[model samples]
Target: MSRELSTRANNVERLPSIPDNDTNLIFGEASVRYSKGRLLGFVTDEYIRAVRSQRKSIDGFFKALRELNSNDAKSLLYMKNSLDDNSHKNIAFDNDDYKNLLIEYLKDHPDPLQEYNDLIYYKIKNNLPEKYLDWFKKDLRCSLFLAFLVKKSIENDVYKGRDELLEEVVDYLRYDIEIFNSDYSQNLPHYRWDIMKSGERKTADILYIKSYYLKNRLDCDKNISWVKPTDNEQINWMYNYLDDKDRKYIILKGMFFPQTINEKYELILASLDVLSNVESPDIGTKDKKGFSLRNYTLYSMKKAWDGRKQYEANNFLNENSSVKVTKENQPKLKKLMKFSGFTANKVINHSIEQLYDELIVDKKND
Candidate 1:
């Protein structure tokens, strides 16, 4: 038992002591040492006066130091054993100068992706240079990162003052959609379209919706089918009911015709009109006046039309005389058709012919 105890003591004494040198340190300690050393040598000091006096010489030194090999840097970095509080105090004073020098070096050597990552890390650690946080969020690495930054800003309530930056990000996302239109073949418009439809950006959303709606309308005018206010008994009933409801005033001209045409047109037009009118209204006005009616109406209309379009495009293959549309003219339509399991070419000719017929009828009436 005594021998065992002695052996254990011997093992304990044999345990390695931590190296005092930075070069032989573990990663965590090395990081701390590096940060502390940077703070001491470059961050604080009469270094500011020295830097001003020998600005060119200091820049040359920094350039040389930056260019040094790994072994040389490790040797020089490990040379310092300890730092005093006065060193820290001096670092605090020289913080701006150090930051400016780093910024100039980074600017002259532009690496957007890496620089963005470094800025984020530094901002999280040192809490220096409040402007760095703003710049980090604005850096255009990926839409995913911008989205994360936006969400984080929202959580921190930093979004209020950063509206311009948010706008820039949204614009970048818009451009990305345009550039990579084919990659989103499954839900091509749905990605950017839904973002706009959320009513987050009133002007931008309205403009996009209007643009998409017009483009779709031009693609398959036959599919459009404007209901003519004929002498049909059912048509008269719907017209009277819609008119008496005081909702007819909100309907665009020629939007309330026959059941087949009126159904989709009224659905789309009503949604757009209501959404356009009520979006971003005053809070009291939105609540007290019940502008939420428009909001709900728009939502329901969008859902109904979207679902119906999907259903029609899906069962189109089983139908006798259905038409298929192409990507260039009706990109979203093709996606909807493909999602619905319709053969691509089956609907093209028939759909185009139907659209042409509708145009003829529309021109005659007009």
Candidate 2:
């Protein structure tokens, strides 16, 4: 996969941001509650580790904690479940020891979020919780999760709005689809079957991006093939070629533009159902161990793209000389053909419509 495609494929794990200043916008109650567990999981590693080091029976620790407050205990477990398995397990295993240790830690560090990081502490201590929840009904855990998400976003430096994320998905989809449109790619030798315990697997990059298209674009379902679809047969072929989960993944990404913030968080929460904490992949390994939610979350928390549009194709063309092709301008036409993804042979053989389609000019211009 191209660097661009890989970046976009991993974008589903991005955390939404809150304003650094006093802004009166509500993120929507559903969205905040939806994202609370994930945000808490990302920040509670240190606390989990400290508790687990002292415990041997994880279930016992939970049972004792449940005795304190079953509802909060359930929320905390949900938060723990959202974390990479190792951290939560090591933090608390044995019942009495882990329970006492956690309670002691909470007593000493009454505000775990504050102790988790300086930035999170600052945001929460300063009264930003009022932005997400009713000031009077503030839940410490939920507020901390929101703060932690913001802190993580600040640390990662990658924040985007619905439109920005959607545009990125479209750009990446275009690049991936066009790059492999050659006879060599059509040959099965260029592709390999995934080794699996069960079920089917396809090319990693294609599988990820195609899912984004199917779910996000109404027109996308009409043309599912690697090549631009010109007929129903081609479209149907690609659609049927996809696994059912591939279709589900499209709905999963929401084209990166969800209708509501709550809807957006709902998508992230959905991942927990399919992925297990035990399966967390080390971000350093890039082999066929396959895409890990761990890697996705880590990578997402670290990337940011500002002013992405400045690098679009039209800008590249504008920066180059603006020249129109006419029957009298053979020299200019010849010069144009020398550009990448173009050549004299291709220009002469393909009609204007075909050339535009192949170059993705129509999609990009839009």
Candidate 3:
């Protein structure tokens, strides 16, 4: 069995690698351009300087106290007595300066805040949580501060007038979506399974496999094969495909599992679903019969389970209560549920159901 699995895995040769330069050409000139260059660079430098200055100030303050001479001891005591007053005065002055600088920057770059605000609004329009957007707004305080604020608000469920916000955001995202969707071959491979999981490729890179290879993979296994359908067969399959959650798992996996930013993939998923009927497996099928039928292999199932568990654990840590779960948590959970064992589909389905229930309660309260 082990040899058989090994041979099967080995037989499945990796798709041929495309040269990085070749893959990047698909993005055209716009892809080559840096969208966040100036803003990102300025923010990074400012953050680094602030951190260094803070460390230096703390070190100097401690050194000054430690090296106080006998004659300066009295002066030190006097300084200590006036410390709160001096500190308050300094704080007020600093705050005023900071505010002035912020205002000047905003005036010079009048549209950054607006651009960010619009960008965030677009995300909300696409079903991102209001609370998350609001949280981003509060946490990322800078030129794009308002945008981050909106993000945090959405994420944390603090953003009100959601319908209005979403409408505005949709209008904003439309332009970018148009550019992204215009070239399918250029964009599709970046979102593919192997490239995303490999981590060798950069996010900005335009990755793709030969269409022929993709079709071959789909048809290799019967159980996992993409099913082709006639016009009559399409409607029944389409209804089941969209309406049945189990059938929709592939869509979910393709859209959400690989991408860090859900919004972009969500857009792509919507575009793909519209352009090609995934219900007709023939859309991506290589051979006449599609792929060869094979049962869900243990290896694939385990891989799926592990991936889902990691996703859930990270999500739970990020959004839920402050109770910290260490690296050992998942292992602990597995131990606690040892009797059940690890089955990726079962674990993911169960976890999602539990999370869905909690979300329902949370929504009701809201």
Candidate 4:
């Protein structure tokens, strides 16, 4: 996942999967099906943003879809059309069969894994003339893209403009991302199927899928607390030791001011040491389900940092240019306090007579 998250921005346009022939790599990755699902998710997200305004324009849609699919199925994502882009394309509509095909495919196959696998199986079963399952993938790409786009757009409350609503019914992805719901997805490597079955496991691809998919997961909401730190070291820390999804919470709920990478690293290391130390308050601590250990540690760091000024104020006295209480005189003051015991009071009154002698000598000299 660290490797995957680190290289995402460059690969947004070029999703990579290992050659199916490479069993070691396949077994070394996330579920191949899941990796493919992430790729399909990306493609659809882009296409959705592009042609969301049209439903009846199946020809134009497929042309656009084919254009996307044709481009190595890993098309470059030029994110066009924000809330401001108004130059909607005028594409001709017809091809009921094409429209029906997409609608039916989307209705039947929920994820790209199924969409991709079904065609692959079909190509194998029938001994189809197609040499590469690649052709079938191209055909289904439109449907897959549309399916996810329709769902995502709805989930984000993004409908087409006033001229945007239409007959095409969108099945929105649930607000609570279903991926995290899976036991295996939440806990990786340990739960991955290949590792359990065989010693040499494959899960790099899964990490990539999860990493890439997470980038666009909350595209719809601006108010969400997903703090995506682009720093490679930070991302590596998250993917390696912490859950990527908990980033928002573990990072002081995005409340912490930015620190240099070295500072963050040091703080995290310090916090971890404190948590593990038997004498520390964090020794037996357990954060609530939603609140993470990192979150607790980060707040503790803040708390400690905040209390420092107060600590110095109470423990150290500064007399600001009056007769300075040097280390030499401090012991004298303490001895005076001890000798006087507050009853005689005379012991306290004399600055041991030294200061009076010095002042009188100075006056006589003057």
Candidate 5:
């Protein structure tokens, strides 16, 4: 998913999946079905903005719909007429008629995913050709070319706008130039604090905010928090370690910023190490769900990564065949680790490989 999200801009004319192949790399390394769903959720900036401008809110639009009570046919007719009448506007709609424009006029506009579902229904009802319909039906491309034709057909009673829409849709679609750039961070391996800043000498619990360039690319800020030390002595030891180093400090691995899931901020840190004498719980504690807190932390880290990048991380961990036991030995190992008094909080601190390593050691000792 990260690969698809990262490379989406370059795939404007491409279909996200192949009819025969079931899955296509056009959407980037993922299952065919998953990629198709993702493509369906994406919309060109033009389409969303147009739909959004047609209405102030979803509630407002629904109110209008209730008033009109027009069937889909009449609604489509009105929408077609409105598009033709308002050619001068950037979005092809002037919102002059609420009865026809109610769908677009809602106070809470439909999300792209919703629009995708409707579009699929439209395609099926019309019995569109397999080649033209499969992208929406089975692939992720939701071809703007075909979408424009659908609109044109409703207005003109002919499907002759494919070429015209293809040319224009490119301008309306949202494509980040960064996605095409080789230097884009999403193109590379994920930002693992320890591995990324391994060469840096200092560790930082508090990081500085530098920029928002990643806002558009990531859809949010990236800064996260460090795992808090349980004791004041451990905290002092951590600060002392930072003070001793001239190198930039990194944050702890297990914790994240309170707003990491919601906000977007560039975090400036490499990695950190707390005092050795500080007794922390081992990384094997389970939550109420019985999964390791470490597993939960890893899943959270996966959330921070773009979808495709998360796959990359998963692949990287999976490549270590020696750690196969982690996947193989599960419930028995969980009980053993619980008996060892490992805390869920402690488990979140280690990487999957480290966790498996610990498991292997404990298994041998037994």
Candidate 6:
């Protein structure tokens, strides 16, 4: 990331680029897509976003959308047989099926996405018709649920009660399923559980609500622990701060980088973190909520490197410098401690006395 190394690092693999003008060179497919999205105002700004692997996140949304589009009745439900109440396989669902479906996509894919797949599934169950989908209500519910979690994230991790947090989720989902049956979430009817007793509950596989029902289904004095995978966009954002790639690359190929225009530099994602950065530079901005647009300027090795650091310093510096990923997450925690320099929490932190002044402040604003 040092400015001095930009020349060699910019096109280390001898990758080609496309000249957009006297200055910029489109590096990869992502850069191309990002350029278009940003030019049109789809992307908010150029900064290191909280998605470590934009490709994976992009693919997840695509797969989720595809899953929603599938007319296959069986695909809609993960058959009750596929998941058992207390069985080992049921408790630990086969994540591989879902994981594979979300990989192999280019990072700055032009495809749209929705992180609320599970939340949406909770709304209508498996009732998405072959056409005429209404995204308004489900989007609202997702927004509310997301806002609640964001508020929780800012709270002191200690004072937070466990079940109270979950109760809020169930309360939202349990509000009569018909609440989302309309095109507008604001138009939802009053909270009610028994709108129609005989209505089909097939799509009622809503997570927290399902947990809410488990208690009613069992007569024994048992405490049901409803566990849901942490795939929420917020959680993934947190993960990106620690899990980002150690280095970014800029080798370009494909149509964007050809012949005479192949040597230009474009500022894509977080260049210091991951490469194989394309116009959708292996290093570019990726907001999980919308377009993974790559922002750029006239090409220059120094310019690209500086722009990349400027962005990273603003968005990801604190998360990268504050925690003990080197200690806690590392097997060397105890042994590294003997050196007297090791200090911090399990993640990018358990504590922060030794954290640098840079980690806590939002440098972009100041």
- Best model number under lDDT: 1
lDDT string for model 2 (269-354, tens) is: 32222222233345334663544443343233223111222333344455335444455766765556534335444455465668
Candidate 5 per-residue lDDT, tens place, 208-296, comes to 00111111112112322332323333234333434345422323212222123111111111121111111234532354343333233
67: Cα error in model 1, Å: 16
For model 3, the stretches where C-alpha displacement exceeds 4 angstroms are 1-240, 250-366
The model with the greater lDDT, 5 or 6, is 5
TM-scores for the candidates = 0.20, 0.17, 0.18, 0.19, 0.18, 0.18
lDDT of each: 0.34, 0.31, 0.30, 0.30, 0.29, 0.27
Per-prediction backbone clash count = 10, 12, 43, 8, 27, 26
lDDT of 1: 0.34
The total number of steric clashes, by the backbone 3 Å criterion, in model 4 comes to 8
Deviating ranges (above 4 Å) for candidate 2: 1-247, 250-262, 265-274, 279-291, 297-366
* All models, RMSD in angstroms: 22.1, 24.7, 28.5, 23.3, 24.9, 29.8
Error of 5 at 69 (Å): 25
Model 4 local distance difference test score:
0.30
Measure candidate 1: CA RMSD. Answer: 22.1
lDDT, model 6, position 354: 39
Tens digits of per-residue lDDT for model 1 on 41-128?
2222232233333321233223323433432232222211111112222221132444444445433532322332333343223222
lDDT, candidate 2, equals: 0.31
lDDT tens readout by residue for model 6, 107-206? 2222221112222233234333312222212332232332222332223322122233333323223332343332222322112122222334433323
TM-score of candidate 3 to 2 decimals: 0.18
